[model samples]
Target chain A: MNQIAETLASEHIHRDEVGAKIGMWLFLFTELILFGGMFLAYAVYRFSYRDYFALASKELDVFIGLINTLILLTSSLTMAMSITALRRGNKKLSLIFLSSTIIFALLFLVNKYFEWSAKFNHGLFPGSNDLLSLPRGEIIYFGLYYVMTGLHAVHVIIGMIILLFMLFYIKSNKVNQDYYIMLENSGLYWHLVDIIWIFLFPLFYLIH
Target chain B: MEHKNNHIVGYGTYIFVWLTLVTLTALTVTVASFDLGGFSIVVALIIASVKALLVMLIFMHLKFDDKIFRIFVAVAFLTLMIFIVLTFSDYSFIR
Candidate 1:
């Protein structure tokens, strides 16, 4: 009976290690398609309205976008390191790195808030008269801008929530050196979000 | 049972990749400031693709993970490319 019980437990853990990761990757692909659809829309519109897209893109503040990009890239670094720290059995350092990642994520969101607020104050949002009065291309530009970045921001929030749960799991020793698929999966999600911003920063902010 | 997190990356590697990514970000920003016209978007996208590759391989550990993950990523991007191409082919003939 003891032999059978041990076999079952070990087999369960073994299956979970790879199976969980595979499952996470599959989910990430679906997310890619979701964002890819938006990207497709942006592409078609931009191709049709090249000059207007360039003109409208200038309204975005490059400095803010640059800072947010750096923050997200650094957050991704810290997230990757956190998993490494955990795998090395240094729980405290891992926790610190993970916490820093969360902090950076919040900072990115704060920057985004100010940036969007400035646009809103200018009445540049969708359905605003100011936006309506703009050229047709610029109108579509701002529309894609809000939808894409807003969706990315929502993803940032989701990544934070996932990492926060990872913190609790690590603290409880539920996700330790031997079993940390949850932490790794959360890191994957965070990196995916970072990757999305990587494309977004160029398409929206740098095109000007 | 052997753990999946067996291939451990050091702090140095992550830091190195981070520095490269930052430098590339700076490079992309600088490149965009110069009005290279059509080449500007091309250059910016190339740089962005490189950065994304680094993040996926190193930070995301697709480098060390199972082959299936990489295959799935490749397939996903390929599918996205197909959609983009098909849409453009249709749109290009519109006018």
Candidate 2:
């Protein structure tokens, strides 16, 4: 009877890995809808105010936007490689790649800070007198700009935090080769951040 | 318990996908520079979609993951598309 009880206890502690992954995917679906709504709004404004959007987009520095895109893309690669490394039981390489991913996230945020600061110095922010004096289309353009990119920046920070925790988990063996659903989930979140920026970069900076 | 069949993606594959994504980014920027007018946004979006797909399938492991995940994501994206189309249809005609 004791042996049977022990077996049952072991089974109880065994996780449903597939279920965990499905749950993460469900959460990601919701995130998609959240950002999808904003994309719809942006499309409406851009369609209605084509000329103003074009003019407003010109004010954006595409060079900076391009650089940020590359940063995020490279970060996504590192994040993926980290997961692969972990799966292959190469903890050291996984940690290295994960740390690089976090560094890239920081670099992306730093660039964003400078970009926003430059706009602020120009008084192009939402509700600024300079922005208020602009045409309605331009005003809405910058409004969407702030709301979309601002929200995206928030996600970047969140992704960084998630990856930071993942780094520790990997080191602690809580997320080893045999148990890495958590790390994979984090990778999914990070990739989603990159995917969002892929669209955002073109919509805001390259549309002109 | 770990699934014994868990497909492991190689580092080389990740690097290849990364290279493709970077190249596409450059392509989009170059395409945007030509001032294609209304068509420019369309072209840019198409390129961005390709890049996003590469990340989803390769980086996110969707390609090796269970079929259910692929179906779920497809449904989610379809729903978003429907919402966008319905909204645009309403706005496009009124203006």
Candidate 3:
């Protein structure tokens, strides 16, 4: 009878772990909705002023955008490799790949900063700018551009911080081969960031 | 913790994604050089959707996840689409 009772208690723990995973997935769903709203707005505006949006997109630096895309794709690859390493119990390899992923993310942000500053210098900012001297609809186009990409950048920063936390968790042995829920979740979030950029690249930089 | 990385489909999907992205990028640039009129936005968005699907299915591992989670994501997207369509209708009907 006592053995039966102990078994039930351990079963409860496993159930709780699965429940926690579901909760995390639900939170991630909410984030998807949030980003989804922005994307919807972008689609509507782009549809309304197709010509103006395309012209505005041409003003963007495609080379910089392409470089950022490559950087993000590389980071995603590293992130996936990190997760694989964790599952394989290769703690050292996991940490190394995780660190590289973080570094690539920072490189992406730096490139974004330069691209944004150049846009500002060229008077292509939202609201009041020389770029707005075109049709009134183009003004709204740039507005969506800044808002969507800016929000994505904010996410990248948040993702970087999460990666930092995961890094520490690994160092303290809280995350290991037997248990790497944090690492897996962080990788999912990182991939979400990359996914957003995948859309943003075409919408903002290649608006054909 | 001894799982094997035997998901060949996932890796193959990533390769396909890279190729598609490159092709679509080039296609968009080429299309932009011409005068596609209003159809350009539609074409661009369709290409973007293809890219999004590849990333979501492969990189995010959504293809092999629980069915309930997949339903949740689908519902969220449907809700967002409904909201956008309603708002756009209002905007179009006003004035």
Candidate 4:
């Protein structure tokens, strides 16, 4: 009876690889749509108050945004390479690449911390006197900047955590060459993070 | 549903994509510094879209993924574009 019960459970478990990926992609689509709505809101606000938005954009440090973009791009490369390493059956190399990816992610968040701190030093927080005293359009611009980038940063953190779990899975031999969809999915999510930043950086920092 | 089809991308390919992405980033930064007026935003967005495409195709392996997966991604982007277009159309007439 116990053997029969185990067989029945295994039969229904059906761990379809492509199906799992399709599900992840569908979830990612929802994420894209969520960010798309925010971007549309940004578009309307910038269109309505062009000059003020431009003025507000100037307050951002292009250098920080540039550095963060490079970091994320590098991280994305490392992430892709990690999967390649795993497929090649080089567990050590894969782990190294994954570690580098996570480090780059941390570096990005560190830069974000300093950037936000500088804004706070100048009293540019959400409800600070500096931000509140600005023109309505400028206020909206900063508001969107904080919310959008903040959300993206949250995603970076989440992606890093996922990579950490993947590392453990690799260490346990659970994500080897023959079965590595977990690692691949994590890489997919990291690339999504990179893609979003590719758009976010220019929209917020380089909108001349 | 081809779960066994795996394409191992080369290190050189990733490096090349990185180079292109870096170059595009530099271009966006340099172009933004100039006084291009309305064209600046459009140029930046176009460059961004290209960078995004490279990442999606290579890093995400969309080029090698299953056909149905690619179809789903295409549908998602199409839906997003329609939403953006509709929003702009409304704003163009209303404002």
lDDT of 4 by residue, B1-95 (tens): 24666688999999999999999999999999998999899999999999999999999998888788779989999999999999998889993
RMSD of 1: 2.7
User: Regarding lDDT, does 3 or 4 come out ahead?
Assistant: 4
TM-score of structure candidate 3:
0.83
DockQ of 1: 0.81
Once fitted onto the true fold, the runs of candidate 1 whose alpha carbons sit more than 4 angstroms away are: A1-14, B1-5
Report clash pairs, candidate 3.
none
lDDT (CA) per prediction: 0.92, 0.91, 0.77, 0.92
List, residue by residue over A107-203, the lDDT tens digit for candidate 3.
Answer: 9999999999998888788755486676966887788888888999999999999999999999898787656767877888898888788778867
TM-score of chain A of 4: 0.93
Candidate 4 residue lDDT tens string, A93-179: 999999999999999999999999999999999999889999999999999999999999999999999999999999998888767
Q: Which residue pairs show collisions in model 1?
A: none
| Pairwise lDDT winner, candidates 2 and 4 | 4
Query: lDDT tens string, model 1, A1-208?
Result: 6467548768774456788888988999999999999999998899889999999999999999999999999999999999999989899999999999999999999999999999999999889999999999999999999999999999999999999999999999888776678999999999999999999999999876
CAPRI docking class of candidate 3: acceptable
Per-candidate DockQ vs. reference: 0.81, 0.82, 0.39, 0.86
Query: What C-alpha root-mean-square deviation, in Å, does candidate 3 show against the real structure?
Result: 4.8
Off by over 4 Å in 2: A1-12, B1-5
Candidate structures ordered by DockQ, highest first: 4, 2, 1, 3
Model 4 chain A weakest lDDT span, ten residues long: A1-10
Model 3 residue B65 CA deviation (Å) reads 2.0
* DockQ of candidate 3 against the true complex: 0.39
